[model samples]
Target: MAGNSDPLTPRAKIAVTAGKAVAAASRAAGRGSGSVIGGRVALKLDPDLLARLAQNLDVILVSATNGKTTTTRLIAEALGAAGPVVSNALGANMPAGITSALAGGSDAKYAVIEVDEKYLAGVARDTAPKCIALLNLSRDQLDRAAETRMLAENWREGLAGSKAVVIANADDPLVVWAASSSPNVIWVAAGQMWKDDAWSCPSCGGVMQRPGDDWFCGECGFRRPTPSWALSGDHVLDPHGSAWPIHLQLPGRANKANAASSAAVVAVFGVPPQVALERMYQVQAVAGRYDVVQFMQRDLRLLLAKNPAGWLETFSLIDPPPTPVILSVNARGADGTDTSWLWDVDYTRLTGHPIFVVGDRKLDLAVRLEVANQHFQVCENVDQAVQLAPPGRIEVIANYTAFQDLRRRVGN
Candidate 1:
């Protein structure tokens, strides 16, 4: 409606009016597209209509490869502590999905949506949020996204004309470069207290030095100011040194980064650092993203490892020892049609042989594991594999679809 005008506008309007009349005439017809979770028919409506739907609402857009959902949920929770908040909790990251989530909440004071990088350019144009949280970009869904640089370029273009404040991860080289070009930017850095990886400079091809958690191009002197809000100081380690006590409900180093990013965004909204951190410590995990479940009388950690980068981050979090494990892979189109990226993962570092492999594409995973000279128990289904798993400790690593099936089977 805001763009090119069609000569059939009158006809289209008449048809829409008639359709609404007929739907009203039918008792089975309810409140329309905004009702269901994935129902996003509003996206097809005129741009003016969609624009009106989001007009004057405070919008927060969160985008990243790995931790977007967790960080988005955390920000939503922290903002909710101040006032009413709305978000797409079902992992809908596209334009239509965002429209559906916003359409459902008319009384919301703030709206936070986890937008996928691929969809950011298009969605940002329509929604035009007040704040955008640019989480670290990592290689993910290479089949669809091609490369992290491509996604970063799209984000830079999408945010070029935005009036919102941009919150970025300062430690990420790509983000640091992008934020340097933006006007209103807030850097969120994980202080020296935590060990994490930083990217090198592409211009000079030099190893970037991190003065604290803020990184700078060692050769180019390209570095932004340090973050005002940082996650630093004392850490409480788990008994086995596998996990550190974050004082937050969520676990892992990635979650800590998420917590730090969320705190920074909320701090921009006038929430004190201490208050935001206190509220974050009470936040819960978004379902399926490192969600802990009780299965077979043991703590079952279900992590969604959809790409090589995510898998690497997960591996860093768990840091498997010489203990046996269970890893599952699916090559279904929905879960990701191509499994060729399996070669990119350093599966050799995994402690011992994968005890069980289960999924529709269990054989494919088995072949990879076998090629690595690792023993595996291939099963037709997850339940059968779970039954055969050793009694001590079991870790289930699954992709999208397999993760869904595993949750249903485990009664989670």
Candidate 2:
């Protein structure tokens, strides 16, 4: 069990057992991964079940707008050097899903949990994690989540009294403001791809001054902190000026940045930078984000980019011009009910490629593409899009629900 020495209370055991059974039923019924439902049932039985399950484990809470899932996976791999690790590897990052993950990995000594940006505070309070990783915060699920500054304030208030060591991105002003109240913080210069939402200071609402790689509020003197670790091009520089080349199975500079952040977080657990990175190098994909599947006689590389910030990073990772790209979008609850976020993306970058748009929100995306003067064909689904694409490999970038649907349909 999670606590071989401490052992769970009888009530907690009953709740966990019941939750597992229901989750199994959910999966058997093809309702989806029953993490949320199962966890909800368990929490209803015991209001404090999450805390009870996480009581004895060394917890690390990872929360961000874009990279939390990938970072959580990397952290879990790095922590494996110490002992078994539990995490919401499937991207089910709510209270119920987190509870389910903990209950399932009863024997895990460490929990590296990916939390939704909105739910981080409550999860932090319950788990009392030894470390919290605060990645960049940008506009995501705008209708569902509060504005960027409001969320930052919420984060600041929530972390004000915590004793956990916070690993924060020094490049994101919003994240810096949010983690400012934490007693202990390790700043990492993980680059931010999107800067639209953070133009104003969270402290004094003054326009921020960006003088190349650094940002400061001219009105309040708020500024980016000096990072103890920094990601420079393909290398990570430690505080001592020693730079380590980051070699990873994962593609893109974003993953390299994530590895740098992971290395810093695991260092608190007594894992050296080299060792942590070595373990992280073993992770090639997270929840099928970068998986390539042979579907309909053609290779389709799956990439998940839910918001503008994510889209900006994804554009850099896709195959260069004329590779043929499939863009899928969905405005379901998980993907946010607002399709207006599409306007924020710079779709003109796909000018030289054959673009095929599909998903429940295909028309919404098509309209946006037309405005950008980018030519695209609206398709029924992934298979149809794949059938029409030019011969050879094709890349597919999708939002939340669309990606999940395609992942299930393609058996990736």
Candidate 3:
């Protein structure tokens, strides 16, 4: 018998024991048990276990400061149109979360994951995905990631020497520059998906000039090529604007970019444009990203505001029926400990008096609103805010953690 006190074999023994426990839990909980138990077990397991699972998967990893979750889901759904696809559908992006997702799938031709930028290198090293999609980078969670440049450096080092086919957003200067070193790179960008703020060239510190559906540095010759797949003209069509004829279920010009990026990956797998477009029109918005629901006998719309860029895009999409607004902020670690980032967002477009401010950081949010000279009422809780607002329709803008809490409180 093996010695119980063997120091060298402790890790192996621990892993074996954990594996047995997971198997037992699976038997007790049935087929869907893995969804509940796998995450916990995977988080506790040795790094080697996660590596083994990653090595076994035919993975496609997606990373970005924004649009990763929606784009990853869309890719998985499009791939699923052809065959069964596995993914961390619950928006879990860490190593253990992804490993648990793979472990839960009984049969899968593809495993698509929304990977966090900081974890991309380690996951890439272990998983060795068949493809990687790098979407646009923007400022987000400065307390955690510090800066976008740091994450870019980490991604470059992580993807070095990998045989994975890289699909990069050429519109983002950082992404374009990062892919320059990679031999296998496919650039995708929407030419007319114009943003006045995103006009800077990462190279040469010069302004990028968009001269007729193409971007080129005025100072440097670094020019963005025409995208393989592009979205042009008005994305929305019709007099009433009740229904957008195009594919996106999510609102705003940014959603169009996300849809285009998803289409690019699907196209790489030999899916025809028509089929991809049809499938895209069928896709629905994920939870907490422009999700709509019925609550309190009225239509309720929920949009998440995590960063300045995201909030700006959401504000642009807010059509005026003059619906009552419920804005919330939170100081949870996941939502960022500092609420200073709120100052960077453009809340001026939100023209309405007596907006309801909820969540643990309601006072901070109210203070920010005051600084912006916007009208708001600080509520003790989400329920009180919802109850106090008019019942015709409620439009909510909330941070990540507060969004969940408010959703639960509103029962939508």
Candidate 4:
């Protein structure tokens, strides 16, 4: 993939320089990575900064309710086999963070961006991506983010005439409907475990009929498109019918699904499935999601699950049975101020585990666990929770902010 070899314009060069300085200052101040703040500053100085920065790079924008961060990382790893890849590897998916990331690697051959579900349209328009990966659509941060179907509709309109090759999950009707408008789409049967958000058709608002692996709207006849790529157990089946076994350091069927999609996206640039999968296998963690941290005489495997759909998939990632599972929740703005989404998640699956609840909204989680008839202990914090548990490697499943808090506490 050839890119413009010319240097950035004088204004663009100045903006990038200023943004990098701000990021460095923020890092020095210990106020968190200045990716977002730095990008915001750069954008304010030049509104077209993203476009100018992205002009020379073949951008791949990844948007989804979940898995976007990990998927973006995987795509970057796979693309790295070809040449240098610039990415927002910190899970900063907004425009500012994306801009800040792009500004750093002007000579990088590719840009793998994780776009916030709400901001995909704007970012896509600005980046003019060579490929767009629509992973899945589910209910997440409903108080601050657009509803699942509404966001899908936005994606549909935003990507209507885009020349980017859209790599989409065919199992998710919401994703299929959204990607349908794209002129070029590579559908992958990346399994969707959570089907709650897509019970109705986004096209006709009719009840969806999911018959085994296939789904169709009886009223309007909107159906699942045949996938060019699919996952059969732990193996990825490319359009050529060759199966590549997916062996990852990252756990769960969800990750395998993510790998399948990532392979497809990188294939656009002629990276073979086997080559891509080999590169992706080295990624053991993404921004500390599945990081194994030594905390409080216990090895804590940090698991992040934001909403019901994400929680469902995360449950599979945890070690099964009498192994203690620490449940944490938070109502911070980043974690969605409304705790009502807690009710939507089925906490009953943790029945066999010694469950402990912690975080700012632990009481809400306690109530939900009670209603689900799953016994749990209410702890003041993760430290107390871990101390209470007869632990070795404790599975700590937390929402966005809670996960970050625990990750920071553990110095991971």
Candidate 5:
């Protein structure tokens, strides 16, 4: 753990103090969030504060379209066995949030940063990280990040100039193409379950096909590279073909894949395989992603499925044990104003399951559920809906603001 005081120059100290004061005022007014306003103030006062925070630090930056926050938590927890880690694990993933977390932990030698997919290039360029973990690239924040291909292009150019060792997912065609040209790289065969985004090759604009566990473009020679670190079932495989079992308190293969990616980076510093897995197993929940809550005389397993891709992963891991599921959606600014992406999500898998539709977008979700012929009930009151569910550990899948609201309402 880092100490109380941060090492800053007189000018930097003034800026950081002013930022803290702004943050305090914002919180007192109940107008802004943690680290968001403070970091903005700090950066406004000193534009180069991020670079200053990066000085002489062993930085490990994690960026992805889907699993950046959870994966960064896995990385930080795994690294916590050695020493303190500085990271924005609370989902404040922008440059401001990154700067705020870094500024506070100024003395910590190790930092596991969660960089936004679009900001990876700029953050990596400024931080000069020792290793950069590149996860799958897909359509996200469509209003802000228009296209996935453009994001991949920016990262491709960013990785080209970076001095860091790139630890990339070999199975993602977009990731493979973006990181293939890097001078130093470690490819991990973290499975790419979502193939909608990779139907077209990024390099030669050719059609791509997935045959067996590998994918290749017909026109160009672009293909899924041979991974040095691979995940097979519940075990992570080493280069020498050794298998080690991994059991996480967190559910889903997505998390297991995340654990493998974190383990790969920890190995760069010579951490034992079992030791890394042990540290990752300690992560039970991240920002209410997979936390089981006792609320309104019912136990609920909260699954934060924000998008179609995330929903796909959650549906795959969901246990069909006759337990009811609370399906909530909200089209807030953070959850994306355009809820039309709901159509792209294949809700067919959720058919024949007990579901309670809630949230501001309940009508929209209920319509989609009915269209899919899935049995569901709409409840304006979530607590009463939970009471109607069978007495057991039920699953709750909620979107951005809905999930956070449920967390506050249930836990409080």
Candidate 6:
């Protein structure tokens, strides 16, 4: 905000200032994250606070069950070439978090927001973003607290009435269905690593056919739209079949798929592919999503997952599992309270690798792993599990609260 000279109305400026003060006070008190309360204060003072702050900026709204944070960060980096990008990359995705972020970066010219699946429509209504990116629709039961099908419907309905152009993944059935109603949708065949959640067509309850990477409903004729942009090996493929090599700071085909979606997104603003791809390769981590935390002389790669779809992506990152892993789980509100999604994941892939289960829900995972005929050792704490890990680099795969707690423990 060194030279951000955009002026806000007097009342609106007052509201944003007050909100920031509240946020600082909340942080000083260590009451909680303070993201929610700060925005709550501002909105209570002026219900249209976010609208005022967003009046002059061109905003991009990113929503998805799994990759919202990472995708948002990538887009923010890509757009930073243009100007200061306001976003809640490290805060909450609800109304309050969005409010606080917008109020803080009030003078920014471009806003790249990460919105929770449930509050996407509400936030969009407040911000009136110029471009909307729907990554995929699914979440742990506690977030939106709605089933994936219903969430997709909500997104479709909300997007239909919005004026923003939509960039959607054509691979995920739910995403394709949800963004279908939007007037201007740019479909990208971003590969979906987890297909179990999208087994049936949301449109006609038809069994979809995955003859290859393409899927279609034989019964209702619903199918993945041909993507104008897609991934080809380690490069992004144009509709003309020209492949542009893209190397990212993040690993896995999933991140490449994310890059593909980000590519299409920035293109909506006439941002060149080189600018977007170059900016993306510099982003190594999004908050704690793919961070390496050091504790007790051991460096652990932190991978966070909240649901089965997330677990699928996480497991892919540890291909040919090297050493025993520190698997953590906690049934807290942030982690969705319900641990049933654990059973849905194909943990049998982890049959050969020894897993040191930790966290509040360790016993529950222990039982599930045993049922799958896998072997594991239960540790009392994350540190103890780390000590007992096989002599090599270890991965810390945890849910919401557990992941945060471990990161905090290591001074992250």
Candidate 6 runs further than 4 Å off? 1-9, 142-144
Give per-residue CA lDDT, model 6, range 51-110, as digits (tens).
877777898999998888888989989888777888888848888788888877745888
- Inter-residue clash pairs, candidate 6: none
Q: Determine which window of 10 residues in candidate 5 has minimal summed lDDT.
A: 1-10
TM-score of each model, in listed order: 0.80, 0.98, 0.83, 0.98, 0.95, 0.95
Strongest candidate by TM-score: 4
- Model 3 lDDT per residue over 65-166, tens place: 777887888788777666678898877788766766766554666788988888887888877788889986767776776476556666776777778888
Model 6 residue 249 CA deviation in Å: 1.6
Please provide, for model 5 over 1-412, each residue's C-alpha lDDT reduced to its tens digit, 9 standing for 90 to 100: 1344343667777778888888788888987465888999998988888877777578899988889889999888888777777888887888888888887785576889999887888898878899999988876555666488888888898889577889999999889888976899999988988888989999988899889888999897888888999989999997777887888998989998998898898887677668889988888889878888888777888888777788888899887847788888998888887787787789888775778889999999888888988888899867867977876788898888899888888883
lDDT of 2 by residue, 187-233 (tens): 99999879999999999999999999999999999999999999998
Determine the C-alpha RMSD for candidate 3 after optimal superposition of all C-alphas.
Answer: 6.8
Provide the global lDDT of candidate 1 against the true structure.
0.66
lDDT for 316 in candidate 4 is 76
How does model 4 score by TM-score?
Answer: 0.98
lDDT of each: 0.66, 0.92, 0.70, 0.92, 0.84, 0.83
Q: For candidate 2, what is the total of clashing residue pairs?
A: 1
Q: In candidate 2, where is summed lDDT lowest over 10 consecutive residues?
A: 1-10
**Model 2, runs deviating above 4 Å:** 1-4
Q: What are the per-residue Cα lDDT tens digits for candidate 1 across 1-412?
A: 2322332244334433443444344425443333232333333444443355456567888987777878888888778767788898777677655765665565787888888878876767767777888877766555666466556666776677578888887667766665565678877664322223335663455777766545678788877566654545333222123223245777667777777777768766776555666777766657665666777677667777877767776777663554446677776665668787777676765746356787777787778777877767888776676677766556778887787778787777
Off by over 4 Å in 3: 1-37, 43-46, 191-221, 234-245
Quote model 2's TM-score: 0.98
Cα misplacement distance, residue 170 of candidate 3 (Å): 1.6
Better of 2 and 6 by TM-score: 2
